[model samples]
Target chain A: DAGITQSPRHKVTETGTPVTLRCHQTENHRYMYWYRQDPGHGLRLIHYSYGVKDTDKGEVSDGYSVSRSKTEDFLLTLESATSSQTSVYFCAIRGLGEAFFGQGTRLTVV
Target chain B: QQPVQSPQAVILREGEDAVINCSSSKALYSVHWYRQKHGEAPVFLMILLKGGEQKGHEKISASFNEKKQQSSLYLTASQLSYSGTYFCGTEVQGNTPLVFGKGTRLSVIA
Candidate 1:
């Protein structure tokens, strides 16, 4: 198994609230990615970080933001949560050959 | 862009074999494979780089075709432990986040 962990394994927030999910890794990998998995859409990228303080937006970046202040930590935030944002969020770390994912956080915005 | 996977669902008996295919319209530099059990994290499977490379872990194997912009995952002599959802992720440019397909659900029964 990979040395990656995700905080708030499960969460429930009301609409218009703020929520933050954290991903921590002990492998010191250079690339980190945040993705959301829904019923029909599968998994879509939200944001990714290649290095400390260096991040990029993915296809579904709207309504989501990320920060990587350190190599081992990557954070995803929903500034103002909405029902549409309710989904399972996953974090992945990449290496030379393949990438490993965290356990995932199940978020439901009611 | 997201990759498209074939056979939304599949059922197999122990000691059987299965194949999952992924196709993308965007130019692909690499292809990755992952498997996620129900309500669990997706474990890293393999990555096929450009120039028709192949790589895998365990009993799984994969191949990439840069010209066709496609990839296929082959599972030989599948076991009941192989029951899960298979996902194919494509890395377009180097350092770019991987875009995943909808995924194929495979159930290996006894």
Candidate 2:
């Protein structure tokens, strides 16, 4: 696993509230990505960071933002929570061979 | 854009075989495969690079058709441990992150 952890393993929030999920990795890999997993919908990337301060949007980036100020940490923020925004968030670090994922954060918007 | 995966779900008996396919709308630099067990984080299975000249992890294998903009995963002699959701993610423009497909769930029964 190489020391990958996601904070607040599970969270329940109300609609319209701002939320931030954190991903930390001990690995010095250069690539970090954030994705959401929902039933019937596989893992869809929301955003990714190639390097410090170098970020890009993925297939589903709306209503979400990301920041990677350090090599080992990436943060994903939801501007305002909505029912449709509820899903399991996973963070991954990529290496030459394969990618490793964090445990995941389960968020529910009610 | 997210690559689309075929056969949203599948079922197999122990010792049987299964094939999951992933296709992209545009030329892909690489295609990645991963499997996630229920309530667990996704673990990388393999990635096929541009030129369709890559294969990864003997236990789980995949092939990429650069010209066809597609990739397929092969599971031979399936095991009970292989029961999970399999996803295919594609990277465009080379040296970038990925956009994943909806996923294909495989259940191996005894």
Candidate 3:
């Protein structure tokens, strides 16, 4: 209910192909984060943006990239998809004292 | 580093109580709790900031111990709706992305 949405709720891409997932928010929050959830890894941060054009890498930044050109949009791209990259990706906005997440994008690499 | 969660899975009967613990090796500035049902995105439960801080939502509550760099979530009189994977995320400072634990799967049966 934080006005966050992730495009392409589900996707299947070929290995070595490029894929980009979009996260759009209407709350105008300054902090936006991208996380991937796997069976045993839970949610691992992929990348995050603090403001427009300001982004930083997380622990699991390999094979992935992110950009935020506007306050309302954050994008995560997989340069070359791999089977290991298959997971549920969630976009979150930190507001007030809590974090709200988007519905999540389930991506599978074949 | 990712936080460690105890009791990878738990099974509780309706009206029973449960506690899930999350510990981190590094110091923590805050701890956040979230729950995700099967095939759904996680939803924020509550956040605990300061040492000894405790917060509650309905029958679910959590405590943060800064000295130990850990947090614990408690659920009293659990319901079937409480069946989900519980995750605890740790933040080292403000505006930083959270690092989540592996998650504790909880199942409540009638």
The TM-score leader among the candidates is: 3
Q: Candidate 1, residues A1-110: lDDT per residue as tens digits?
A: 77999999999999999999999999989999999999868799999998999999999999999999999999999999999999999999986668889999999999
* Strongest candidate by lDDT: 3
Q: Score the docking of each candidate (DockQ).
A: 0.83, 0.77, 0.89
Question: lDDT per residue, candidate 3, B1-110, as tens digits?
Answer: 99999889999999999999999999888999999999888999998996789999999999999899989999999999999999998989875788999999999998
Error of 2 at A108 (Å): 0.9
Global lDDT of model 1 = 0.91
Q: Flag regions of model 2 displaced more than 4 Å.
A: B54-59
In order, candidate lDDTs are 0.91, 0.89, 0.94
**lDDT tens per residue, model 2, A1-110:** 56799998999999999999999988898999999988887888899988999999987999999999999999999999999999999999886656789999999999
Task: Write model 3 residue lDDT over A27-97, tens digit each, in one string.
Answer: 99999999999888899999999999999999899999999999999999999999999999999998657
Instruction: Write the number of the candidate with greater DockQ, choosing between 2 and 3.
Output: 3
Query: Clashing pairs in model 3?
Result: none
TM-score of each: 0.95, 0.93, 0.98
DockQ of candidate 2, scored on C-alphas against the true complex (2 decimals) = 0.77
By DockQ: ranked, best first: 3, 1, 2
Candidate 1 is graded, for docking, as high
Q: Where does candidate 1 stray beyond 4 Å?
A: none
Candidate 1, residue B28: how far the Cα is off, in Å = 1.3
**Once model 2 is optimally superposed onto the true structure by TM-score, how far is the C-alpha of residue A61 displaced, in angstroms?**
1.9
lDDT of 3: 0.94
